[model samples]
Target: MGVDGVFVAEPVSNVLGGLACLLTMYVTVYRRLGR
Candidate 1:
């Protein structure tokens, strides 16, 4: 159970991290374009 939980949690955290990185890049581009 613990190992299964770790596997599930790892993907979720990775996805969240990926989304955060994409969001940061999008905002940076938007700001640059806005300027």
Candidate 2:
């Protein structure tokens, strides 16, 4: 159960973190280019 929990949690956390990072980067670049 613990192993399964870790497996599920790790991917979910990584995906969220990656998306957040990508969104921030995209916004920053878009603003810079817009200006």
TM-score, each model?
0.90, 0.82
Each model's lDDT comes to 0.98, 0.98
Candidate 2 residue spans exceeding 4 A from truth: none
Which 10-residue window of candidate 2 scores lowest in summed lDDT? 1-10
How displaced is residue 16 in candidate 1, in Å? 0.3
- Per-residue lDDT for 1-35 in model 1, tens only? 69999999999999999999999999999999999
Give the Cα error of residue 9 in candidate 2, in Å: 0.7
Model 2, position 3: C-alpha lDDT score: 91
